[model samples]
Each structure stands twice: as C-alpha cells, then as structure tokens.
Target: MMKTTSIIASLLILSATTFAQSWTVDKVHSRLGYGVTHMGISESEGSFKDYTAKITSSKEDFSDAVVELTANVASINTENEQRDGHLKSPDFFDAAKYPTLTFKSTSFKKVGDKQYKVTGDLTLHGVTKPVTLDVVLNGTTTNPMSKKTVAGFKITGTIKRADFGVAAGMPTAMLGDEVAIRANTEFIKD
Candidate 1:
C-alpha cells in the first residue's frame, strides 16, 4: 500500500510540473505603447504605465501558448499633461467609464521559427472586437540574479480607432484612424 501511494504521488507531481506552465510579465522590463499620426504629419506616441499580462503554455517552444493582458486606461501617458487628460476624457478612452482595456488570446499559432500569430478579443472603449497581432520571440534565458527562466517577446499590431468607438468624431487628418500597437515584454516563469 505504501509503495502504491508513493507511485501515485510521484505521477501527480510529474504531471503538474510537465504541463501548463504559467509565466507572468516582468513589469520592470516590459512596455505597452501605441503610436498615431498627428495632423497627418508627425507621429504621436504614448504608453500605459500600468498593465498586467500572463502567458500559459504546455509546450517548451511556446507553440501552444495563451496570452491575456489588461491595461489601465487611466495610466496612459504621453508626457503631455493636457493631451493625456483629454485622452482620459469622454472624447477618447473615457477612463472614468471604461477604466481598463483587455485582450485574451483565442488562438496562438506558430508561424515561423520564432514568430507567432496571435488572434484575440480586445475590449476597449466599451467595445469588444477580434484583433490579430504578430509576436516574435526574442529569446529565453536564465536571469542571473534570480536564476529564473525568462522569455522575451515583441508584439506589434494596428487597430482602427473608429471600430472601437474611440474618438469617433476625430478625422484621419487630425488623428490617424489606425493606432499602431507595440509591446516589448519579458515574462518570468512562475
């Protein structure tokens, strides 16, 4: 009876350790940013100061990973106080009403040696829509200080602001309809 119980416990431990590894964003080494053309001339850029993201995978190559992220709209920063305030108002994100934007991956498919196509539902400005993003796995390594496994990725995509009812009255000549999204993220195994 003792030997049988030991065998069962070992199996359970092995299964748990081998499947469903969870990774969390290392906030200090990650950034979520966006860019939009201003007045059809120069590009305006901004970034969210607060966000949370997680990745889950059972495969070593992260070919079958699922990613989910949430960012606080109020944390938008463009280094300009007035513009940031306006973005938080009803004209744009309406941070008071929406509070946050989110993304949850529906499909994560490996497209190349270190590239992936991630399709997910993005909820922003009180609207939910499907969006696809390209992800490039920079690499994975062990952190010298913590001795923990860490993975780096870069994600890029573009979304139409009008589709999500963000700044519906804004014209393309003033603020470009397409917002370019980019994020450089580092995830630590948990």
Candidate 2:
C-alpha cells in the first residue's frame, strides 16, 4: 500500500507540472487594431505599432489561462500622420500622460469547442472598465525552426470611448462612441 501511494503521488506531481505552461507573444505575427465610425458616414481604422502580451495556463486545452496585454498609446497609427498625431494628443488618448493602454484578464470561460469568453479590465485614458471579448483559439502547432509550441488566437470586443474618459472633442454626432477592437495574436511556449 505504501509503494502504491508513492507511485500515485509522483504521477500526480508530474501531471500538474506538465499542464502548467507559459507563453510569450510573438509580435511578428500579432496585430492589434481598432475601428471607429467617423461622422456617422465613414469608418476609420487604426492599429497599435507596439504592444506586448503574456499568457500563462495550466490546462492542456488552455481553458484556464491568465492573459495580460499592454499597448503604447503613442504608437497609434491610422495611415495618416496628421490624424495619428491628433489621436495621440490630449483630445483622444492623451498619449503624453497615459502612454500605455492595458488589459488583464479576470476570467476565461469556454463557450464552445474552441471559443472562449474572456472578461477583463481594460485601462485606457487612465480609466479602467470591465470588458468581455469573444476569443477563438485558432490552433496550436510546433514551430519547425524554433522547435517550440506556437498558438494563435483571434479576439474581438467593443468599448465606449466616453466610458474611459476619452471623449474630448469627439462629439456623438461627429464620432461614434463605441470603438471596435480586434486582435490576432500568436504565442510561443516558453
């Protein structure tokens, strides 16, 4: 009985260690973007040029994971230099003061086979609010060159600029309050 107990305990420890893992974001294959309606007639799209994401999980399927991301507000690009500058000014993100926008996942719930509902606190313009994102686990594979496990995910969500105190000169009639957020991220197991 004693020998059997020792064997079971060793197996349990190995299983626990095998399940827990850490992943590092591969910026080369990741993109974070946002879109907003302009003048209720057109839509403008932009992307952040600098960001980082770290994820930790213990589940084999990544059902239990903690995710954190941060983006540089000053790196906002909208294809137009002038507009991009304006977005970084005090009227919008106030990049000079709050230079970084961050998100930290509080909970992750599996809604489908590869779909998840991720609820987290998003901090923008110095204000934090709860946001839920629909996330899809694209897939996981082993990198041929790096010999590391890689995973891909697509996430989508929406947030109100006014809620985060980002409504400076952006009036409702001129600019939409809701901003659509989308991200395609790849991670390498570390």
Candidate 3:
C-alpha cells in the first residue's frame, strides 16, 4: 500500500508540471509602448527596447497563460535624443533614481477564442498598482528560422502616471491623468 501511494503522488506531481509549458520573450520581435497627450491635442508615443519576460501556459496555449515582465527605465525612447534625455531627468521618468519597472500577472481568464483578460500588479518608480490588461492572442505559429512553436500576444492598458511619481506637468486637475500603455510580445517554448 505504501509503495502504491508513493507512485501515485509522484505521478501527480509530474503531471502538474507537465501540464504547463514555459516560454521566454523574443525581444527582437516584442515591443513595449506608451502614448500620452503632448499638448492637449497631439499624442506622444514611445517604445522601450529593453525588457524581459517569462511566461507559463497550460498546454502551450495563451488562453491559460501566466506571465511576468521587467523593463529597464533607462531604455525609454521617443525617437528624439533630446527628449529622451529629458525623460531620464527629474522632470519625467528620472531613470537615474529608479532604474527598473516590473509587472507580474496574477490571473489570466479567457473572454473569447482570441481574447483574454490578464490582471497583474505593475511596479513603476517604486509604486505598485493593480491593472487589468485586455489581451489578444494573435495565434501560434512556427518560426521560419528557428522552427519552434511560438505564440504572439498583444496587451493594452492604462495607468495614472502621477501615481508612480511621474507627474511632471500634472499640476492641475484639468489635464489627463492617465497614460495609455501597450505591449506586443512573442514567446517561444523553452
């Protein structure tokens, strides 16, 4: 009886781990982006080129996925070298003080065949906030070069920049307080 019990327990544990698949971020194909109001009418867009994320999915399907990501605050770029320098100053992101931003998913639920809701805690500038992202699973495909099983996903959300100590010009209550955040990531089974 003892031997049978031990065998069953080991099998259960093995199945639990096998039922999930792990993936690493393909940084070359992934992008982190944000948009905010520039001067009341125009919008400013920027992308972070340096970031890393890990994900685990049940059966290698994104519908049952969990993910965590970390981004370097100093990697922010808006295509303008001058503005990029300003963003790293005290007037904006202040990358020198806080060098990293992180996100960890708490839950992932399927809303449709191609859509999902990912709820996570985002840490920025030392502040952490709970956020829910609308995600679209762009489907799975094989890479021509690597010939590996890859999944694509797009997630978008909004957060109050001021809450993370990014309030440079948000002195009054009239201007927008939230910034649109988005990310596109491709993951490969590891």
Pick the lDDT winner: 1
Q: Which candidate number would show the highest TM-score if scored against the true structure?
A: 1
How well does model 2 score by local distance difference test?
A: 0.92
Could you give candidate 3's per-residue lDDT for residues 1-190 as a string of tens digits? 9999999999998997888889998988899899887657777889887888999987555666788999998999999999898887877877998898999999898898888899999998878989888999898889999999898889898888878778556552434567888889898888
Give the alpha carbon lDDT tens digit for every residue of 39-95 in model 1. 999999999999999999988889889999999999999999999999999999999
Cα distance off (Å), candidate 2, residue 146: 1.8
- Pairs clashing in candidate 1? none
Count of clashing pairs, candidate 2:
0
Model 2 over residues 41-149: C-alpha lDDT tens digits? 9989999999999988998688888999999999999999999998898888899999999999999889999999999999999999999999999999999999999
Residue ranges of candidate 2 with Cα displaced over 4 Å:
1-18
* Between candidates 1 and 3, the TM-score winner: 1
**Please, what is the whole-model Cα lDDT of each candidate in the order they appear?**
0.96, 0.92, 0.85
**Sorted by TM-score, highest first, which candidate order results?**
1, 3, 2
Give the range of the ten consecutive residues with the poorest summed lDDT in model 1: 12-21
In candidate 1, stretches whose alpha carbon ends up further than 4 angstroms from where it belongs are 1-18
TM-score of each: 0.91, 0.90, 0.91
